[model samples]
Target chain A: MIQKEYEKNEKTVTVSVVNFNPVWGDKAANLQKIKTMVISASQEGSNIIAFPELALSGYECGDEARRDHKPCSMHEEAAETIPGSSTAEVAKLTKELGVYVLFGIPERDEKNPKVRYISVAVIGPEGILGSYRKIHLAPPPTFTEEACFKPGNDLPVFETKYGRIGVQICADFWVYPELSRILCLKGARLIINCAACMVGQTGPEFIAQITGCRGTENFIYAASASLAGKERTLSYYGRSTIAGRAFPSFKQIFAQGGDREEIVSATLSLEKGQPPFDQLSLEKERIRSFELCANELKKLAESR
Target chain B: MIQKEYEKNEKTVTVSVVNFNPVWGDKAANLQKIKTMVISASQEGSNIIAFPELALSGYECGDEARRDHKPCSMHEEAAETIPGSSTAEVAKLTKELGVYVLFGIPERDEKNPKVRYISVAVIGPEGILGSYRKIHLAPPPTFTEEACFKPGNDLPVFETKYGRIGVQICADFWVYPELSRILCLKGARLIINCAACMVGQTGPEFIAQITGCRGTENFIYAASASLAGKERTLSYYGRSTIAGRAFPSFKQIFAQGGDREEIVSATLSLEKGQPPFDQLSLEKERIRSFELCANELKKLAESR
Candidate 1:
């Protein structure tokens, strides 16, 4: 295990979203590309930098039935263990830059090296803290996640000096908002989503719209990084975004173009504070009020 | 009861959202204004037209403690019983136009005329269909609804010739995605939202964003009508919108301007269809997959 070192000076953390398309099934090249981004993001003063889903081996792997598909040839061959090779290199970079990095990778199950799981890993200067598996698997034929990988079962919130961070893979972030709500209930102040969804197929406007609500409704900071350009037969939607509470009232705070590979960054406040509109607060008291409202409705329903 | 008549012609329903500014606490004037808008919506072939929260009496009502306040002077005077003078007139018009209308009105509780509930009533050629009381109440100072109106108890889905419909008031639509989910589970094919949220306070972008998600996630059509212009200290954000599942995809189909009075209309297909991305489907099979994923996470949590 390597020692991890983080900047002890700041409470305000600048988070960066790296939106870039990777060469399908190429691990060495993807890692090399991300290393350069980490250096650039660090130079730009980002305390935490995040990348799109499956950034290590790309995201064009076909479903279980199509495992032998062209792009996925690299999935099994390139699958790496946590401390294997990618994180070791990422860990060194984080230590040197004093920045934390979270990126997606296709993990090879330890007991059975042939088995792979869609996963995201967090690495600091010291070493790899841990990883979160993609809980929600996209069904075929839009996303073949379930076809090739075993779905992840945990919704882990990583604790840091700045705030508690919760992560969700691409499709997991959509449909089931319960994932985000539960994360917030568990004390996560910031939610990060890593995705490699197709571009023109699912418009960036739609992604931005949903991403914004997740942040505002939960009264937490949300940052998403998506793959840009093409990933095999699919074209990725780039517009990576970072949004905050709508109570204090703000617009599209940080967003990237749908057609481009770019890094979007913003400084987020993680301190527990009251919203300008008390009605939008995510505090326990506010949650209690909502419960009371629910109870009142229950009584009314019974009476009716 | 007067005889009612409606055009029994088509399965395709054209929904209209009436976005307008209401005179504070003036029910008669507001009714007159809506009458004109309903005629226009009918002319555009809309079978169903929706109006903003308290469209008949305005939404600037202060809490019970602040009833003596000037804006709320009409609460006692303006409160009317359902199927009262207003609905009687509205029903006549619905029959004449051959259309269904959903609008907000402050209802004088039948058992106790002194008490009122923030309610939305549905009227067709057959007269009053039913009503939904706002299940969730916004707390002060964003809104003092809880201080005045009792929270509603039922999530009723009204069955019509075209499709099943669900109603949610302003604040009820936000915070709880479960409200929409339950309506969908109960077979609502269309969800209507009536809102009078403040302009600069709750950004139009936020409202529009959340409204779109409610429709897409539920695989149902969603329409929102919000009050425009200034009422007392609050200026309503009036971007009435109509959204549906992008069929084979997801996005907001039609939306109106934020600071204007207008009717936004869209003809939607209510037939069960697959999402643009098959993985995005909300059908029972897909729902079951989500349950399985959730169960897996639960097991993982227990192990940890």
Candidate 2:
């Protein structure tokens, strides 16, 4: 496959994304299709390339996913190891194209003996940067994705050539605010959210507000890659989007087409902007106020 | 006192406010001071006249704030019932001026075997509409005023001659989002914060943003009554302000007077503006995106 060579390097932050309309359960064909898209991303000069969650073998595995499920989750069987063929494919392209990539996969946990994790692989210039698992599992309405995937406990922030990087799997951004807070505090100028949201749920507006509020509250940049388009069993909404604090530097989006997938690109500036000190100070006032209110009423005794 | 004869037949939202510079220990002078302010608020056509916290006796009561130490905390100390003395004073004015008045005092909570509450009284045209205790307290380093006050827990949102009315003490606005959220959710279109904030202690920018964000998030108006001039023992910063999504109200105020304990007023239209909801939505987006990095980031994201 002919990979795209990055076109610009003028201190510009660029985004490369691939939108795959894969045939579910066919890992072999999906990999072949992804190879062409990954190459195109490299040729187009994407500094950071991202793919949808569970893109390796497609999103709906059902019983197959169950069989592959680790002791606790379907995600256990999602991916084999860091050096698995999927990693090799992306690593080869990343090394050759000289760019960063964020992809989703299922894997077994090395610790705790039997738990498997649904994590996003963040491959950087040096090697696999790290992985962030879904913290807030989408229980009820979404039907047992958590039954197969073990939840991630620690929040990890990494230093990369671009900036301090923070990553999280799908649904993590929706329920928990602490993860976002931790990332911002760690100086993650940019946080990437790789999600697989189904059709007919709280659409783009809900996603935008959730991500936007978190970014505004913490003063950090947030980018997201969502699954798009539909194939049997699952319909991925194709509007994959990127967001953050810097302009003309971090926006890139993608859509899907027939039989295979397509890659999209954009530019992002990773420079630091407003520090979060002011906002943090602002929140401290609330806590102080809480104490004051309680104390005065106590002195008032029965007043409380 | 020629109390303002406000028209209940008319649809007007009048906000009553009291400006106080506490002596921290003086009650007699503070009481007299509120008497004059309440009379003035009533005479001047304020439908809802309010006062700073503990205006009846200065907020700095320390250990002497308890009912056992002071008769003011006892209703049998019998200032007035609904038409008691303080209530009588406000009622006479509201009835004379045809307006409503809300003022703060040390309330003897008669319900729970003699609890004293630092409360604000809402005196309507007919009688005492209701009372709200300082639910949130101000504790130490919180300055000279922290050690004595007890916090109130139940937040009561009342419906008056105007739209819906939600009354809260000073620091209450800073901590919980639930109070304002409930008010708006309950159809209270306007939120009035009765407070006494210190200079340099409270960041104006943060307050404005919080107010604006709250308004936009809940779709309503926000008004705050902060002490205008420094009273004995306190340096009052008089920049009481009003904010809402229904108007194009923008003002550039760098430094305001540290003196002048007068009622500074503004007319806020609860009526809808000419702009469509979508236009307003976009306008809101633009204003929120004012921070250069966020705006640029949003632009880039959308452009891509």
**Model 1 compared with the native: what TM-score?**
0.86
Write model 1 residue lDDT over B127-233, tens digit each, in one string: 88978888766666556666677777678878777767889987667666656665665557789999886866667776677788777666677888888888766
What DockQ was computed for model 1?
Answer: 0.29
Model 2 Cα lDDT, one tens digit per residue, B159-195 = 5666567776665554344355444434466676666
Query: Local error of candidate 1 at A94, Å?
Result: 2.3
Q: How many pairs collide in each candidate, listed in order?
A: 8, 53
Question: Cα deviation of B4 in candidate 2 (Å)?
Answer: 46
Q: Write the per-residue lDDT of candidate 2 for residues A1-304, one digit (tens) a residue.
A: 0001112223456775555576665666766666667677777777777777767656654654335432332334455565566777777777877778887776556654356566777776677776777655544223445556666666777766666768866555543443454455445666777777666543433344444434444455566666667754777654555544332211112222222245655576544333322323433443343334334333433432
Docking class of 1: acceptable
Q: Candidate 1, residues A92-199: lDDT per residue as tens digits?
A: 999999888999998888888767888888888767888889876766655566666787767778877665688988767766665676676656677889887675
My TM-score estimates for the predictions, one after another, are: 0.86, 0.49
Q: Is the docking of candidate 2 incorrect, acceptable, medium or high quality?
A: incorrect
Off by over 4 Å in 2: A1-11, A17-20, A61-77, A111-114, A246-265, A272-304, B1-304
